[model samples]
Target: MREDVGEVTTSLHRPTTDSSRSKPVRYESFEWPQQQQQPPSNGVPRSAWNRQHRRLSRWHRPYTAVLVFLDLISTLAASEIADVFLEKSKSGFQHKSWLFLQGSALFTFFAYVVLPLGWLLLLWTNGTYDRRYLGLGSEEFKRIVRTSVTVVAAVSLLAFATKTDLSRGTVATVSLCALLFILLCRVTARQVLHLARRRTGHGAHRMVLVGTLPEALEVYTAVTRSPAAGLIPVAIHITDGYAAARGIETPVPVYAGRDVLSLVREVGADTIAVCGSASAEPGELRRLAWQLEGTGVDLVVAPQLTDIAGPRVHIRPIEGLPLLHVEEPTLSGPGWLVKNLLDRVVAGLGLALISPILAVIALGIRLSDPGPVFFRQTRVGHDGRTFRVWKFRTMYVDAEERKATLEELNESDGMLFKMKHDPRIFAFGQKLRATSLDELPQLINVLKGEMSLVGPRPLPADDGDYLGDVRRRLLVRPGITGLWQVSGRSDLSWDEAVRLDLYYVDNWSLTYDLSILWRTIWVVLKRKGAY
Candidate 1:
């Protein structure tokens, strides 16, 4: 065996869990890699962890604030467009710009003023406004939508009773347009920002891979395949001879059979992504993590089950020890009502607002090729109910018939079938999906009350067989936009999608609804997850 000690340092170290706690995990003298030694036997300094936390948050805080600001603007603009058109238009023919302005101001006042107050109530009632919920998922968007609707309804009633002379055409036009336009702007901004971060390197966090060579390679392949994620893998450190002999050469340097703690220090790595199932002693894992605790580095364990998402895996503390809890997904009761109400409101609004866009898409589809303007498919919805989900036709007439033969090229996870670069899509269809204009027809499903503004995903009935604990998802109506669509859409593993839906089910609130609606803008505009 050849020993290439690039930078070797050794030290005897003690692992401490806390300065004030009772017994800590005691370890004898350990041979750390020849990179760096622990400071004189007392303990490893703890300030390092704090530094990493600050660094990570510093990068994220401004970006999040930008999102919030953009969301506010969307709400304002939508209302203004509606209001301005109404104000300037005559009795029969409403002025579009005046309606837009009126809608923008109304939506703006409603969102920033009325909705914030409701959020305060929600905070007092259900703690929905806690900072922890921000950027978590669709919950925040759900609340925003619901609160805005409430304000709109209240204003509608007041104007009617007070004889305020607000034109129905104008009110409807402005209200709908404001919401749509505002959402569009926010989505556009998010995609731009995410891409900017990926390119600038300011948005991503770096991690070192730790495992057997094979397992490390698996993780490397996965991370590298999606550079848009902003993860920069700086180096690889193998813990065994088996990994070292694998002949895998990475762009970054590799060190073999090095002590984990030493590698963390000298490499200046702030995090470690543990891969594969190697039975390392529990004591050793704890020691390595404890030694690096104050350094701001983190340990992320990649379990063998690659299909599952974070929300599905729950950790519980049992008798002073931690336990992982996996819950069955289900939607029930008030969750259904909240979802239903949102569906009705959003569907009504979408149909009205997108009428022009729908016409445009329909004309384009018709002109591109000879076929019906709309495409209908039998997709399963709430309680296994079958419904015809609609989209502006994006494929040839025989697409469904051709689907069976092309199953071999399916590149999706779980029961969901997808082809990243499917040839079946018509020339114009690709652009439609990328911009999400194709799904506009599903607004009819919303109006028919077969779907919602937001809920668990809708799947093809035959595809239902692939589900495990998936029926819980159907307790509420399906949506044109749902947890899966907003989070990562086609890019997610089936398990990851299920986890998001279940999270929505377990914690269904108006706030969650608002968050999802808001996120839909970015999901559609970024078009990263669209096929």
Candidate 2:
């Protein structure tokens, strides 16, 4: 069997229509057969194609197998532990005769065999083993939790329907322990996978980006920014016709989108990411999906929506058409009220717990510099209200007066001023800033309800007023630390900082605040991007 295809490389030169400007423009073009004109297949045997497809896409199988083994161990250990606990407490449930087993034998049979098998079945049925959710995002954990809930509900319903005297304590203990153990195993597995991807690019998808030049480049940038997400671009398929005419330069080999299936096969790409309006033609996307049906290539559509978190977006299928519904941001309401209440409570407790350290730092600051122990500055707060933000003095008393001399040395690219090594910061102050202990005094602001435990960082009043959409950051109280601070603090560009702040304002929740606070601890310990 042979595949019929044609490839041609040609150089064309066209002279200008005007005699006064008769300079010829030269360009290179490569042409291939149209989509319908190309061969239906690569002429490989079906068996050989199956073998090749498995070889190309089974890279994650070993990782998935490891998770399965871990889950098995977790469930078995949980059952045995529950059995031991029940036995020691003299509260074991009596098992009546069932087939050839009775009493202790029957209990052991169910505990050792039936329980683990049922747990694994539930996990499989809940899609816990899906490769897409394995090593990224919170979906894997969420699925595990959902599986655990299902197990509890199923067991309870079975006991009720059968009128079996099932021990409530046994079920709760086994379910809770199994959930914890499996979650721990998954966290460890995810960290290992992330490390492998970062170090060796292992277990990553070989992605082919399909879109116009600009849209493809945008998707490429976003995916490549976080290499841990594991969508590696191997080729580009330009959907628009003007790419060749304008001679657009791309990071990877560029092909006309007329034959994306052929392009994927040629590049050995396992994922095709369609970006922006690449499939604007009617039924074009569905046709592409049809072409990729059994070839083991995953088709992913990258919508133009950027920075929208998953919780706010929902897919509602109406008449077999999926419509994306975006819930409005939780700027106010009961959830916001809960967030504000928790902020004050956590702040108050933090201030009380860290009072001794605060005093020691204040004394050290007074001894090292002749300035006030606390540095107070007016900052724009919620609703554009001006609040006096407090921080342990980390600069000289005359730091404000010396600002003029260092204005020429500004290293930051925004309204803010930042220098990696500023003469204004004293020795003790550098230590304070390095560990972010300087920001601890802001807990007082948080306690006073002028700041939040997690939100956008408040800007100094003198540091240019917020303009345009940037003012949205003021909808919530400024934070002691936020996405901007944990992301890179002084290292992020002005626009990037604003983008993160706006993202926080649009996605604020108690869970988000807690995640930020957790990341802040790690960022502070690493002392990354700090002066």
Candidate 3:
């Protein structure tokens, strides 16, 4: 059995004797292997792993900062050449060394000095430079790109509105160059780090995996693929009796036993990565915690949650229990204000920009069907209040009657309803839904204050009534587009849908809302998970 008592056992010596005088006397010396024992030391175990991690984190940022600074300086130099070329073409190839010098200096100041500084501030705000992000996924890259673009965009707008006489061509040139160089540099750095990690077989923290074969395999794949995360699975402890076949062909050795602590120490891992059910009793997990209290090792529990972002999960300690608090998603309070304001402003601009297209869709719908182009249905909204949710009619008027016949084919779980390939969709409705054209009229709902630009998808009364204890989805104003729609829409399981809504509810922030909006554009463009 695995042990965490800081004790090791060797074969014990036994005296040979016969109860009766029938057996001949045998003299033998058997020496077992020596067992190493720790000397009496401090009660608290030292964390060599933590020290290494912290030290690496300290050096990571300055390295990236230097790369960013040098890249921007290179971009400024490129912009100078581009500006000189444009000037010569405009002024009969005149040799204006003074003009070139002045333009180059200005570009250097704005792109290299100002823009990088602004990016640094934004990165600080977004936690982009956090040590935890160092060995993570493309998330860090995405954040860097986002922060850089935002800074450049802000500067551009400021230059345009304030008449700063900043050369627009030079700004664009430098911004594009800097963005490309930064992305390339980051990608190269990741590749180098990945190679180094694999070659040395160091940097990765050893892990004792506790789960069934299938779950353990999944965890193993995740850790192996993400080398930068530094999670290395050294041993897997299967709880099932010796009958189940191992699911993964991992280089790491596998052992079956009930002693979790022994397995942890045997594998030389302080971190116990729990993935699935184990042979140990449920209370054993807590008891193991007690055993490792001052061992300076972390117990990392990997829940079955997948594809869920961290911002959505909330931990609330309740009555000495660590209760997970999932908030219902809504667009209200300042979010409501922001969405309402954006709705009016963007809608007005869109109407002015795309009046012809809106006119075309209206005329096409009118021509296709001899009914109202706008379909409004009663949907449960914030605080369980009902509102008329508007959409371009993407179904025949008898779609409700048809739904009753398809109830047996409903694919979704709990109160939600969905079908992969529904028979009730109108001729153009399939195209409309796939491209998210049906959601356009909801901009009117946004304007009417019945909906916001982003929130949980407003559910109809039939589904809402069947919500049982899961109807916390109505806490905030209904949204035109929401976490559900962008995430997987009709394809998501009921639990996942509710979990996402709860995540949005608990972590409501303007930044999150904007992120959702930005993601919505991609979701719509991709048309993934849409029926």
Candidate 4:
């Protein structure tokens, strides 16, 4: 209720899911100061749910205040550092010197008070400090950029409107430095929060999932899979007779829907997340909201929407009744042209930047084997068009010919072939493969317009594994590294690989591409699931 983003509690004591029982119930004593049921059994001195929620509620404001303080300090430090640097530049900054001499007090006020306060105001106006945009996602970073630009625009407007004389170089330096510092500080803060969440699910809300068996397990799996910036499912409240369904296998309890209030009290739930299946009619849901008025728990109603990106979603309120609107995915036209342009430019520069490394790798390949330095294979690209994809040769010359002999040793599913210790690979090739240096040659294909820097990975042209309705993958050009590459590579199941590829195809955007490219660096460094 205080702020929206996150909150949670911790305790080793948790509920157990009983498969055979009608409802998995915990017998923690439930009592009110004055109760009428069963002679008022005494409650646990302090339930985990209550303790966790209380901590979440109490610390929400203080935590947000700390974030705001960090922003202000970062802004001031950047301005001061920029001031010191600009004082040394001597690039027509005589105006600053004149200001110091003629308006020393004004200069002090401008540097120490006005600019910093103005920055804070601009950030607040731009929603940089809003709880809804504070943690995770590029929205926060974008807001910071917007705030900085808005401040610059305002300054330029003032200069034009009032003939205000200012040092151009100093103003530019301060603006650039402030923007950089804000981004750096925000990124660092998110890293710290991520580490905290991963280490211990702190700053995440404790959730009571209210849904039927199938629907409840969906939410449960989603929350558990990504614990960072995720809801911690404390308990599952199933509809009247569906509690006995064996969908869930967690220590989190399953309760009858009628026992929602008691379960919430017992588990110290901070939020009640009502999934579409369990969120009765509008009238019933409204009444339920009334029933939950002062419980100190946030009520969230989730519509049954899946796999839709935030940009395509709009919530329209017609006469105070919320209606969901979903825009179809953008698959072509101007955006696609931009994605292609970025891919080519970045790939061109990438190939040039890494030419030295490529040469070294080529030398190693020549010394290791007498075959060609590049391995060219036909792979399907945009619109099912086939193009030759290049990679540093990591296999022996006759490896393809010997494929039949090792067919029995295949360890991978789908059309793809993978073996941890395949005889086809050269000794030096293993290191190259493990380090992902073998894929560097694909940048040439990327530069050639046959591939993109980010998209679904291209499979072998003759490999018809994903050619059904999943041809949706070929709607865009293939990529050497993509959702599949970053999401565990060869370790991903066939279904999982297809899912990731399709998700990329369906929700492609410039921002999304950049995010994946950023993630790709970490994934490559770790060599997770690579072989």
lDDT of each: 0.62, 0.77, 0.63, 0.72
Question: Candidate 3: where are CA atoms >4 Å away?
Answer: 1-131, 134-336, 464-469
Judged by whole-model lDDT over C-alpha atoms, candidate 2 comes out at 0.77
Better of 1 and 2 by lDDT: 2
Compared with the true structure, what per-residue lDDT tens digits does model 1 show for residues 1-531? 123343222211232222232112211211123323343323455564353323222345566566556655655555456445545564555444222433366646653566444333433243233333343344544555565565468667876786665556755664566456534654565456557656775555566777665777777766664555555666776666434644555666675545554545445555677776542444555566566553445677765544444555788988855566776543456755666776778778878887888888888999888989888888888777899888788888888889999999999867777998887888998899899888778889888988777778788876545355687787667777777887688888987788778657665566667778877986787897998
lDDT of 4 by residue, 280-319 (tens): 5666566556545444466787668755667888999999
Measured by TM-score, the strongest candidate is: 2
Worst lDDT 10-window in candidate 2: 8-17
Off by over 4 Å in 2: 1-52, 91-103, 242-249, 318-320
Tell me each candidate's TM-score: 0.54, 0.84, 0.57, 0.83
Model 4 stretches with alpha carbons more than 4 Å out: 1-63, 89-103, 157-163, 243-251, 291-294, 405-409
| Better by lDDT, candidate 4 or 2 | 2
Residue-level lDDT for 469 in candidate 3: 35
Q: Write the per-residue lDDT of candidate 3 for residues 350-390, one digit (tens) a residue.
A: 65777687778878777777788888888887778788877
- Number of clashing pairs per prediction, in order: 58, 0, 3, 4
Residue 309, candidate 2: how far off, in angstroms?
A: 2.4
